[model samples]
Each structure stands twice: as C-alpha cells, then as structure tokens.
Target: MGVRFLHAADFHLGSQLAAGRGESTDHDETLESAVYTAVSRLFDLAISERVDFVIVAGDLYDTDSRSVRANAFLEEQFARLAEREIPAYVCYGNHDPVADAPTYVELPETVYEFDHEAPEEFCFPNADAPEARIWGQSYRDRHESRSMYRRFTPADDRIPNVGVLHTGLNPDGRRYVPVGRRDLAGKDDIHYWALGHVHDARVFDDEQPIAYPGVPQGRQITEPGPGGALLVELDAAGSCEMEFVPTSPVVWRSVAVDVGDESISSIPDIERHIERSVDDLAATTDRFDGTSVSVRDPEWEVDGYVCRWTLTGNGPVHETLGADPEAVYELTRRLRRTLAGRRPFVWTEAVRDETGPPIPAIDDLRGTDRVIDEFLALADEFDDAARDRFRDEVGMLWQPVDDHEEGRPDELALTDDRLDELVDRARERVLGELARRRAD
Candidate 1:
C-alpha cells in the first residue's frame, strides 16, 4: 500500500479575525472560533483518511503569547492523533519561534516538534528500517534572515524523502527564513518540500512537490477563499499524487457589483441589487460545491461568506448615497439582515459606495465656458499633483490626530493603492460640487 499523509501549515491560532470586529457577541465568538474549527476539521480528515503521518509546516499559533484555550485546543488535537497512532511533524515559524515564551503545555508523544539548532530527521515505520524520511527545522527566533535550506542534508534516495521548512520564499526584505524554490529543488534526494509562511495554497512543481497549504481559515478580507491542507499519496515507487481539502468554516470575500444602468433610484433599489448579487454568489457556490469548476480555480468556497460589498459604476442613486453616510450605514445593516435571514448566511461587513454621478459627456461641456474649462483643467492638475503630494497633504491632517493617541506614530504612511483611493474620492467630490453648482 502507498504511504499517505496530510500537509498543512500556518494555523495562526489565537488570531482574531477582523470580520468579528464590532459584531454581536455570538457572531464575534463564531468568527473567533472559525480558525480553531478549521483546524479541527483538518484533524478530523486526517483521522478519517487514516494517514500514516501529518506534516504541519509552521505558525500553528498566531504568536508565542497564546491564550490558555489555544494551548488546550492544540494539545487536544495532538492527543487525538496520538490515540490513532498517527505521528505529526511540526516546525515553528516566525510567529511562534523557539525563543518565544513556552506554553508550559506538553504535546503528545505522537507529535514531533523540530529542533531550532539543526535539521532533524524522523523516519516512518521504524528508523532502523525506514520506508519514509522527513527532515525539518524550527525557527530559533522571530526573525531568521539566513537560509535554513543549506542546513538540510540529503536523505536516503531509496525511500520518499520530505523536507519541511518555514520560509519567506524570495521575499523583498529580511524578515523570516528566506529561501528559494531552486534552493530546495536543487536537492535531488528530497522528493517533497513541505513549506510554510506564505498563506496562499500553492504547489510549485508536481515532480518534486513544494507546497504551502496556506492558513486553514482566512482571518480577513485579504485572505479570500477556502483555506485547507494538502493530501499527498506516495506509491511504493516513491512517485507522489497531491489533492487539496477545503476546511475553512467561514470564507472572507470582497465582491464588486455594478449597478450602472439598472434603474436603481433609491436605497431600496441598491439593496435589491446587492441581494441579487448575493443570490448569484450563493448559486455559484452551490453549483460547484464551493470549489471553482474553472481552470483558474481559486480553491475557495463560501458556505457562509463575510463580504465587503463595493457598489461600482455610474448610477442615478450615486449622489443620494454620497450625500448621506447614515443612509449608507443603514443600507448596509439592512443588507446584512436580509442576507442573514436567508440560507447559507452572508454577513455584509462593509459596503463601499464607489458609484459616480451620471454626468453629461465631457466633450459636451469642454469649451462651453470658463468655469467648465477651469474645472476640467483643475481636475487634470489634481490627478497629476495628487500622485506625488497627496500623501504629505493627508499626513499633515492625520499626524496631529495620530500624535494624540498613545501608540500611534507621528506620521502616517500611505500605500500606493490607498493614495489612489484618496485621489479618486477627491476627483469625485470636485466634479460633484461643480455639477451641483452648475445645476443651481
């Protein structure tokens, strides 16, 4: 029989999801427990599959300072594996490095935590007469700039050799353990590289699998889709086959719905449009059973989605929405209520009004008058100047507020994307004001 095992990483336990922020007490508990729930499901799958062993690459906890509950949950899971005689190999990532304060809780005998000093090898069946060899190393501290890949010695080529490490593959700066695909791939003796740190489920090459099983549960809008572990099957010849199993209880999604020419004149119309969009999403999820049935399958499913809705495109109700922030908030609440009232519930975390006024053609007003010409010229100037100077201008307003706060910095840094947002808002506000004045 072929040797089978589960590959997973970046559990990030004790991490709080932003989706639960400002939510009801029960909702907050659900969101907080979602990560743990996903982890439990992963263990459940491992037990059911009766895999020989489980490999957890790293970041099992969000930080060294974990809650007692998080500690208890981990011990419970490891004990479950021990009961079935299935071994677990784990390495520590930057988030839960060796130098971090100990939890004082002992892991089960079935669990093998890699040493921080050097690469250690664990053999399946028995070390004296091994069928598979797994090598791994934990992080010595929170920041490991050097490449740990060099420390790994080649295992015997006769059996399936798996090398596990927590690294930031070809990262921009030195933060976590830095290593490259070629660095590990160059090792001929290693049949598989079980990687962690990056929270996006990826398989580098099928021949010698180098995979990151991402976070089991997405904790924010940025981590969209289904997060799960990889199941690897190794034949007697040592050839491998891999499959991903979805385990996240709740999926975080950011969806944009265009209501440009949909005759949406009021908040109710916008609400209906949003409801239809949610329905479409639900239908799509149900049709594929949460996994995308396309070539570019994101491997994300939404049994229950925490969504950030963006209303896009020019519409008649644009001015109405922009004019009243309270109305938009109320609309968001109503949308959330409407979605939650339905099956496969959706919680609308946020609603962004990206709609613009249905203005006349720019060509029609180009040279009509001085005000129009001046306004158009100013808009162009603003776009160009905003790119370079908007951050400084905004920082002046933000710095004073930040300074007053205890932990806030004196200067606020803005990302390129955030700058673009500010520029778009400025342009819209200018044009809207001009149009309103002209109408007057």
Candidate 2:
C-alpha cells in the first residue's frame, strides 16, 4: 500500500569529527570509534521503524581516505541493514572512498551502491504485487560542478520514483561544489530528493521535497549542536513524510554568564550563577525541541563537565583553588560532584579568572612619627596611580584607617597616622614594581 524508507547521509565513519587539536591523537582516534556506536543507534532506528529500505545519500567517510578500521566499520553498517532485511542504497558523495571506481567494498549483498554514469532503477517487487522503482546517482569527483541528474529519467508512470544524491544543494558558491535549485526541480524521476553535504538539517523547496540530514554530531565549535539522521515514511499510496532523529551521544553548548559586582560577592552567589546557567540552557534546549544541554567546560570546571575538567585560570583562581579560602572552592567542587551523573551537566575545571586590575603592593612602614607627614603627602600623589594599579591595594589602605577610627577593639594594631604611612609606602611599592618590569 505504501513505500516506507529511512533517508540519511553523511555518516563519515571513522572521520573523528569530535577529535580535538590539543588532545592526544589517541584520544581523537578513540572519539572516531564512537561513531560506530552512533551507527548502531541508527540501525536500531531502522529496525524500530520497520522501514522497507534505507537510503544513504553520500560522504560515507570523513574523506575518501580510510584505514583498515574505517573500512571494517563501514562493512558492519551495511551488514546490519542486510540482517534486518532492509535494502540499503548508497550513493557516493565527494568524500566517498569509492568515488572514482566501480570496484565494490566488502558490503553486504543487500546493499546497493549507486553508479555515476547513469541513474539505475531498482525495482523492489513485492511477492504479491508490482515492483516499486527507485533511482540514484553518485558524484564522480570531490567537485562535480555539473548536475549528476542529467542522465536520469523518471520511473515508469506506474511506479513511484525516488531520487538520491550527495551533491551540495545551495552550497557556498565560493568554496563548495554548488548545485542550484533550478537544476534539481521539475525533474520527472524525482519524487523525493535525499541530499547531503551541509551539516545543518533542513528541507528545501517544498515542490521537490529535498532534504539535508546534517552531520550526525559536531566535530568542532563551528559545528556545535545535536547531530543525527532523518527517518522518512511513505504510505502504500506513495504519500511521504519524514522526521529527524538524533543519534549523537554527546552534545555541545555555548553558555554566557554575566558577572556584575554584586554577583561575585560570595560563594553562594557564584553557585547560583552556575546553577542558573544550567537551568537556562535546559530551557533553551527544550524550546528548540532539542536534547538536553551538555556543558563542555574544557579549561575550567565547565568543559567536559562530566568526563574531564581541564583546570584553567589566571593568578590565584588558577592556582588549584583550596578549601581554606571560604566555601567558594568547596562550592565549585560540590557543583562538579553533584552534576557528575547528570547527562546534561558536565563540569570542567577550565575556569579562568577574567578579573581585571593588577596586584597591589603591601605596606613597608616601620618606626617613625615623622613618617606620618611624609606618608600624607605621598598618599595624595599616589592615590590615582594606586587605583590604576589594583583596587585591592587601595581598598587595603583604607581598611585600617576605617577600623581604628570606628573604635573596633578587636581590630589589627594600627593608628590612623600609622595607617597613612603604610598606605603611601604600599603605593610606591606597586608603582616601583611596574617601573622595574618596564625597565627590564
């Protein structure tokens, strides 16, 4: 009664999209192996949906380049389709390993690799009924500027025609191989265009019903998002429908938290900030109808929030935070501990201090009453420079003066006169250090 098929492309097996530049090559290679897991998930999708056939548009590998392992994984995917009795039709995109040759890889017998020379019709003849026809083509090179569809004619008027390709549809004209809308539209043999190349999923030109399933998962910051494939279903009467099903085990998200003066006053505030960020991400993802947010706090207690925390920071915060400094460090550790088992939360110690201003100078004052006058004159002159150096120094200078005058009996030993002397000398130390560095 209907033709139901699963449409997907850009598997890029062993491509290592998740590979990182700073990571050891071994780690990148391990990430590459993760694709096999994603592929298995797709097989589950196919079996669960009970689709009659699966169409793989193109770019089956990250590149035409392959190692023994990549090739082996490729064979496994096709074999799985065959095991389920679902015929799979594969077309070679620019990155296909066999793009230039008719030679077959060790694929399962049920898998049909399309040709470049002409559109071949595959008739799936039901035991009790007539055959359903599907046509497909392959890209002969990495950049086939011309349309590969010129050779294909529609299926006989009696059969439903489905067309598949791996060429760039609306690709960036400058660098990518470009295929235009005009070229694909009004084609007689194409009922549905299962396309590939661009990694963002979308359906284009309702008249043609062409689609791009995007990459299954992101490889870098530029590609951050949920990555996966598409499932297409058609009725016995040949009416078609499709839905996107994500297969990525990991997700990437970018979160921005604004730090105002009030927010950084205490540990509880910082904890609340982080919690709110995770909550906001959850909300945004829900609104997008996407999977949960997976924080990647690489250099701080943020990236790889679950797997690893690459400690990164400047000055004190960078120095492997300690439990002695209030409860803030403990709070950070607690957040990491609490979010460990959560799928959407990943705690990385990539926290870097964006704190502004520079370190201030401490006082070098000692034994002399006349030092008060000297300190007063210098303090007036250095006040502006002290602000420019580090606000902490200026804040420290005023603390003793304020404390003693307030008659706080438990305060550290110091008079207003002594405090002024200390303040002036501290300013000189900071300025002198700056000058010394410049001199060097």
Candidate 3:
C-alpha cells in the first residue's frame, strides 16, 4: 500500500489582510477569518481522505506575537487530526521560530513538531510496506542565514524518505534558509522534499517530487489567485504522485478591461462591462465546480472573488475615467454594492484608470514631429529615469522604522518589471494628451 500525506505551509495565521481604503474594522475582520476558514478546510480534507499523515513545512503562525485565538485554532485543528488517528509533522518557519512560540499552548500528542535545537527524524513502519522516514528541523530563530539542508541526512535504512524544511531556493541572500535545488536533488535516499516559505505552489522536480504547496489562503491582493495544498501518494517502489488541492475561500484576482471600443462611452456602460466581467469570472468558477465533482471539497468551489480592476485602451470613456478620479471610485463602489446582492459575490478592492485618449495611427502622425514624435522620445527617456529612481530610492521606504519593531512588515518593493509597466502607462498618457491637443 502507498503512504498518503498532505503537504502545506505558510498558514500565516493572525496576519492582517489588506482592506479597501476607509473600509470598516468589521470588514477587515471578515477578510482575516477567511484565511482561518481555509485552514480548517485543510484539516477536514486530511480526515476525509484518511491520509496516513500530514506535513506542514512551516510558518503556521504569522508571527511570534500571534493572537491567543490563532493558537487556540491550531490546537483545535490538531485535536481533530488526533481524533482521526492521522499524524501531522510540522517544522517552525522564521516567522514562528521555536524559541518564540508560546509555551502555554500545547500541541496534541499526534502532532510531531520537529526540534529546533537539532535535526530530527521520525519513522513510521507499515505492516504491509516499506517503512517511511520523515526528517525535519525547526527554525531556532527568526533568521537562519545558513542552509538547514546541510544538517539533514537521509536515514541509513532502505526506506521511503521524505525531507521537510522551511527554506528558499537560492534566494537573494542567506536571510531565509537558502538551499540549492541541486543540493536537494543530490540526496540519493530522499524520495521527496517538501518545502515552504514561498507562497506560490510549484514543483521543482517530478521524479523525486520536490514541491512547495504555497499558502493555503492568500492574504493580500499581491498574492492573487487560489492558494492551496498538495496531496502526495508514495508507493513502496519509491515512486510519488502528487495533486494540488486548492482551499482558499476567496480568490484574489487582477483583471484588465479594455474600453477602446466605441460602445463604452459613459459610466453606466463601464458599469455594464464590469458586470459582464464579474459574470464571466463566475462562469469560470462554475465550470471548475462542474468539473471538480466534489461538493465537500472547498478547493473545488470558489465562494467569492476579490478583484482589482484596471481599465485600459484609448477612447472617449478613457478621458472621462482619467479626468475624474471620483467617478472611477464611485464606479468601483457601485460595482461592489451591486455584486453584493448576488450569488458568487465579487468585491472590487480597487479600480485603476489606465485608459488613454484615442489617437490617430502612428503612420499618419509620422511627419508631425512636434507633437507625437517629441512625446514618444520623451517617454523613452522617462522610462529609463523611472527605472533608476525605483531601484535606488524605493527600497528606503520599506526599511524598518526602528530596531524594536516586531509586527511591522516590509513594504512591497517595486521590481524592474513593475517599473516597466509604470513606464508603459506614462507613455500612453503622454500620447493621449498629444493626440487630444492635435484634434483640438
């Protein structure tokens, strides 16, 4: 018989979510609860599937300063697992280092939390198949600059070995337990490597089955799309099969709607367009639901969507949306209100106006050097300058406010790719202005 287990990490319990500007505390609380709800679904899945064990790579809690409620939630979930006779192996991540975890809250006997002081291995001997060994270590402190993988060595006995660690794959620095893919692949005895820290679910290798299940639920707009866990089945022959199981109640999505078409002229027309977009998103969810064939699994059903809308393309409506920011805000508010009254709700967290004025073809404006040509050249210069400014100055804004700050998170720094996007928007705006002037 095969050894079945679920792999997940970065629960980040008690972490605050990003709410819309001026949103009430109640709404923010609801968003926060959505994450926990997703976690509960994970435990439920373990019990329902009768998996022999569950592997939580790390970052169960968002921080050492986690709330009592978050601690209780974990205890309750573990107790549920214990009742089902399913064991859970967990390692502490940087966010919830072993040294910092509250001593008052106790984990259930069924849960095997790796020791922070040294690397440890737990072996489960099956009556009918080869024994399985799981090797792991917890974060001793918030910053483990060295590679933790060095401390781990597969057990001597010929058995199915699984390695778990909260690490990054050749990250920017040694801040997070950085381990190379080749280093993991070099381990001859280890059949699977379950990793954590990164929030996007990905598979590094299929044969040996190295994977990151990502965060079960996304807490910010930046972490768009469904977040979930991985279900792994390992046979006696040392082969592994894995499946991704999404568990997020609310999915974050960013969508761009082009308004260059002549039909989209007024705010109401834009509203209708947004309605169609929401319906389209719902239809997509519906299709997934139909194909999933499992109503009990939360991964199969998308309860709702939180979207960030970006309006693009050149038209008269672009001028209106760009000229009046309030109108755009109102449109977002109206869409949110309208969607709230329906099933498969969609909340518009933000609306960005990236629309530009309609312009004549570049071929027509080829000789008109003073307007279109001059603007294009200037746009090119601005793009280079913008990239430099962001690279140098923007990082300072994300630095720690003080040495003692605990809960303060690092600001999301702008990347070169993001800078290129901003430059593109700026170019469009400049062209739109020049075109309007030429028409006038």
Ranked by TM-score, the better of candidates 2 and 3 is 3
Residue-level lDDT tens digits of model 1 in 121-238: 8888779888788899998888877687776775558788888988767534475766667777888778889998877676777447677777889887766777788888875464
lDDT of 3 by residue, 340-383 (tens): 55566677778888787787666676667676877666666765
Candidate 1's displacement at residue 43, Å, is: 0.4
- Model 3 alpha-carbon drift over 4 Å, by segment: 21-30, 125-130, 236-238, 282-300, 361-440
Model 3: how far residue 204 lies from native, Å = 1.2
RMSD each, Å: 7.7, 17.3, 6.8
Residues 124-203 of candidate 2: C-alpha lDDT, one tens digit per residue: 64424644566777766666664656666763545556777766554334222356656777674566778877655666
TM-score of each: 0.78, 0.61, 0.80
Q: Count the backbone clashes (under 3 Å) in each candidate.
A: 1, 23, 0
TM-score of 2: 0.61
Winner by lDDT between candidate 2 and candidate 1: 1
Every candidate's lDDT: 0.75, 0.55, 0.75
Q: Return model 3's CA RMSD, one decimal.
A: 6.8
> Which of the predicted structures, 2 or 3, would earn the higher lDDT when compared with the native?
3
